[model samples]
Target: MKKDSKSLYYKDYLKLDELLSSQSPRSKELGKEAHDETLFIIVHQVYELWFKLFLHELDFILKLFREKEVDESNIGRGVESLNRILEIQQLSIRQIRLLETMTALNFLEFRDLLFPASGFQSVQFRMIENKLGLDENMRLKYGSSSYKMPLAKPDASEVTKTEKEPSLFKLVEAWLERTPFLEFKNFFFWDQYSEAVNNMLAEDKRHISENPNLSADEKTFHLKEYASTEANFEAILNEDAHHVLVREGHRRLSHKATQAALLIFLYRDHPILHLPFKFLSKLIDLDESLTAWRQQHALLAQRMIGTKIGTGGTTGNVYLSKAAETHKVFTDFANLSTYLIPRSALPDLPENIVKNLGFYYSPESDES
Candidate 1:
């Protein structure tokens, strides 16, 4: 064999040296930090690894969404990715609790050692939000000294070439714009769903027109209404394809993605989709869990560091509590359902079953 190029070895290949050297202990006595500081560092590293997986899944799902053949099958992939994302989130929740096991007394040993560090700077977490189409203007953060994202920005907006593009949300928003109006309108609950979406879009447009401070990107999004549908819209649902997407989306590995989409789809469709509330109950459970996690995190911080400012530069427990409160799950949608269900006729069920089944909505019945 020809001699390997000198660059092919350690220099050009794996940067193992740099990677291994990244973990720098603050004190000479590495083992002296109480309450498993090594475990703390390792756990955070592991969390980042999971977030990386989420980013991968999100990218793949969004790509599927963009294809011209977008349907339940493609959407299912997004759902599966979502499910995997949820698994990672569950692990994160558990990891968060690991902090509770250690008292502030124990943390004090390594408190000073952990100079400027907090989960606030998690780039991968931001990537997940971007992929899901959450607001990104204030969300994106890089070093104040540097103008560009160290990693590629998923969305391209910044003038500075040094700044990487923005996140996948930009791409998803564009994809939504390109999506054929007929195809989106063909889903089971087309009319009402389209109405809700249009309403939201209309509101967005008004806000854009009136608001002086709206960013250029926000204005562009509001001005261009990509999806348009009439109130009496009726289109063929590719039953086979739809089922395939639903099944794929519901795959255990992609629960969160599926859940998020389904939540949106159901709300848009309203009484039309008529999916079993039992199916939605799972999402409700997840919402409860997320809320609980936030509560616990706030408590843990309060107990550990008291009223001190966080390493992330905010009032520790107070800031954390507000962050937790912001994650309200399903309050708006749940409220909306009260109006939708009673106005429509109930689905056929066994006499006894019908009598016992409390007022509930099922998405499955919307199939037409």
Candidate 2:
């Protein structure tokens, strides 16, 4: 049979002609082309294309979270979508290695032609950060300049609008705050968790005091460290203390939301809680993976141009390294590990709660 007239052609469907034609090296226009300019342009263009796909998956995940009451059936789908973004980030990091193949000397041939036009002007990258809840205030200053200062007016306007929208971080925190499992009937999670945590800490103190291996100096040091650890724990267990940290900008999650997360973590084995646990874990992974990408990109920049300013006119790797550390958006979820107690130390949840956590079947039918 002849191919149908309506059938998709591989080149037409992917718009390969347009993509292949888009790379016109500035060095080539200047009458002495840098052989590596094509590689440089192509790498960044590929990153932009990947950014487009990343936003698509991220948009779907954000939709699922935007709901007043999240549909449980869609959670796994959201997580799978997030995993795709995570993979893309990994790919983004690996692509830098490919860029590295073009040596610094090769980069120098045409680097000046692109002056004042830096990767800092990448609007799509800014969009991803804004969508993921990177606060503008948290952004490192590029010499008293907003990051958007480099973008064209239209691009800048688009990024500004993203700030008004609820970010993924905001939505997830709200969902955690509203988690129903925190308080049920007589199952006051904080009360039990506090008691367990105190008991666990007291046991720790006993070991440190009684251990024959520790000298008096070591014992004193350990006790002071224990007090510090206990204070850190109190910062979570006490609402007033939690609020104080929030006010100081050291913590972001609300007290109730933090407590809910701690409880879910402690009893993650419960069937109903497993999904939430997975969701939290994925966010942490995504956050860390993205940070790793930023650090790698910074290193790549440093290798390409040491201590010099970026083509975007910023203090190249310095700006990037600071951004990597400060740009992270999911610290609250990652920090929850500090609150995690051993499985043995977790308070036994009520039987009724445990049964409700998973599907249960009755041996006898209700109909007689």
In model 2, what are the clashing residue pairs, if there are any? none
Weakest ten-residue segment in model 1 by summed lDDT: 229-238
- How big is the positional error of residue 43 in model 1, measured in Å on the Cα after superposition? 1.5
By TM-score, the best candidate is 2
Which stretches of model 1 miss by more than 4 angstroms? 1-23, 29-35, 136-292, 327-338, 342-368
lDDT of 1 by residue, 99-211 (tens): 67777887787888776667655666544544444333332223343212332454223223212344343443343333222122233233444455456546646777778
lDDT of the structure predicted as candidate 1: 0.49
- Regions of candidate 2 where Cα sits further than 4 Å from its true position: 1-5, 211-217, 357-368
- Per-model TM-score versus the true fold: 0.52, 0.93
